[model samples]
Target: MYSWHTQDYLNLAANIQKRNFGALLLHGAANSGRSELTNELIQFALCQSPQDLHACGQCSSCILWREDNHPDIVLLAADNSEERKTLQIKVEQVREVIDFASKSRHLSACKIIHLPDAEQLNISSANALLKVLEEPAPDCIFILQANNINKLLATIKSRCFKYQLTYPAWDDALKLVVENNPDNAEFWLRYFNGEPLFTPPFENHELTQLKATLLKPGIDAIFALSKDLDPKRVGMASLLDFMLKWLSDLFLVKHGNNANYFVSDTSAMQGLAAKINNDKLFALQEDLVFLSRWSEHPLNHKLQFENILFKYQQIYV
Candidate 1:
């Protein structure tokens, strides 16, 4: 389990045991404890002796879980690694879950399948998963996690017990960040908006450079970014997200408010914001919104980045 969990998880876990729900969907923003809480539920389900709705840490099932040797549980998520970044849940992987479910449990009384980012399942794979959920195994449970559930198919959403998680308060989030990573804790915390589970899309130095260069956006600078713009190496979505946040902060700075995304670059933000008229900024925002609509699709990533660079260059023109 994570360092923080609300009583909501506890109540839900209790209800899981009480009702024996076949499927549960945990939806939340990035860096919330959705994955950790899901693991806790897995352990609680598999534990031969659960105490107070939590897994008995010393139990054999808990030991297997700690060792990451729980055969009965499978995690299906986009690896987002350098070699193989993907949002699509391949049909073959979904088949594995179905195959795994058809068999008997190995060590525990429970079997679980966890799908992180259920919205990433493409049409075929989603249909494949839907079939499994429609006729799940007697001893199995399915846990679906998504940061944005609206992208999920209605059929998939309808099959599960959905719960949306909330972020911790600033004091609690800061405490967690500092306790876990003291050095550069404040910087990273603010960068991720205090999501402990968040993995930075780029290194600190790279992000800083990106911010500086975008503020002085020129053709050469835009092309310099485009040269290394493969989504696998550095995500287009993350870049767009950064741009959106930066624009938001710029808008705030224009109105005599402090910058949020560029938390350290108040003067730079003010200067940049001053250069652009509201009409130009609004036009950029419209383009970004259009790009975001197709950002997750395979075809539009490069096109979106191109549009963003063009728009960024125009902002200062």
Candidate 2:
């Protein structure tokens, strides 16, 4: 368990021991350890001999969890397929969950249905799941996890007992990051918006090059960066995310506020923000936001990236 979430986990465990909750919705920012906390709670609930609100490793239920074949736990997640072209939790998957919930627990006291990304539930699936939530089956607990609860249906959100796992204190989070990456701890911590538990990408050479190009953007540098970054290799979504954060910082700096994500590049951002045309920058930001939605599409990524870079360059003119 993450040190920051220790208190929340204990409180939730105490609640679980007191009375059964039909549904629990754990919503929080990405990398806030919501999934880990949910898994720990499930293990604790299923353990025949829980030790101080934690699962006893020697118990049969704990052994099953370790083996990755917990009979009473069902995981529902988005369908990730190349052909599907979208991440969605289909109605068929929810139907399976309904069926699972109706059945008896094979090994544990109660059956658990874990939906790691509840926001991925499409309209049809959400409706199907709603029926089960409306009339929850006995000895069944539904654990739903989402990064954004706004994407969920109001009816669905209303049914579950919501628990929000907020970002940890800056010092506490920084300490965790420093332990694993002492050299670039502060840099990475700021990069992820202070999310401490994220695993840093193995190679950030391309990102470093991109940052350099952005810092001193010109026609030649922009064109070079567009060609140098291969969407397949570096991930177009990642590139867009980096650019979005940088642009956000630039906007903040333009409005007489400090940089939020790229604190290390505040001086550079302030310099650029002073020279940028506000209207052009605003248009570019909107265009990038629209393009981000299609970053994963099978379109020509190189051309798209080049176009975005060209637009970005225009903001300075």
Candidate 3:
């Protein structure tokens, strides 16, 4: 378990030991270690011999789980296929969960249904799952995970024992990052919004080039960068996320606040913020926000990206 999430793990473990919950919802920001905590809890719950509210690796249950052959655990997730472009958990999957929950455990005392992305459940699937939650089968535990509980149906959230794994303290997160990556630790920490576990070295060449262009923004550079943006390769959503963070930091610098995401580019941000028209910058930010909703759509990605870059360039005028 991550040091930052140790307390949350213990608290949830205590609850798990106290009594069996029909449904447990672990919600938090993306990459806040919710999945990790859920896995540990599943192991502990399924383990025939748990030591100190933790799974003992020597047990047959632990061995099966470690080998990814735990018959008692069912994972429900979005269909990630080339044909199925949408990121929704279909009702068919939920129906399977309902069927699985109705049966007895194959290897353990209880059965666990793990939905790692509960927020991806569409209306149909959510309603289907809600029925199962309402009348959960005996000895069946549903472990739901969501990045944003707000996106979930109110009824689903209400039925579960909710636990939030908040972003760790800045110092604790920074310490973990520094341990793994001594250099640029602070930059990565801010890049991932203080979630150190996901702050690996930023080695994506496309993003690297894009950042370099932003540091020295020019009409020619912006156009060149837009030309190289392949939606399938780097992803339009990823591009929008990077731009959102960059714009957020720029807005902060404009208002005399420190850079938030781009800590390493503070000097460049300050220089750009000083020259750009505040109103135009704010308008560009709004435009980005609007575009993010359609980033994953099969639109004219290159043209849209070029238009955004042109808008950013015009902010200097």
Top of the candidates by lDDT: 2
- Pick out the ten consecutive residues of candidate 1 with the lowest summed lDDT: 78-87
Q: On residues 134-169, what C-alpha lDDT tens digit does candidate 1 reach at each position?
A: 988878899888888898899999999888876777
lDDT per residue as tens, model 3, 118-206: 88899999998999899888688888988879989999999999888867888987887788777767877777877777744335566
Candidate 1 — number of clashing residue pairs? 0
Better of 1 and 2 by lDDT: 2
Model with the higher lDDT, candidate 1 or 3: 3
Candidates' TM-scores?
0.78, 0.94, 0.89
lDDT of 2 by residue, 108-134 (tens): 877889988998898899999999999
For residue 165, what is the lDDT in candidate 2? 79
Off by over 4 Å in 1: 77-85, 180-187, 199-238, 263-268, 283-313
Q: Which ranges in model 2 have alpha carbons more than 4 Å from their true place?
A: 201-204
lDDT, each prediction: 0.78, 0.83, 0.82
Clashing pairs in 2: none
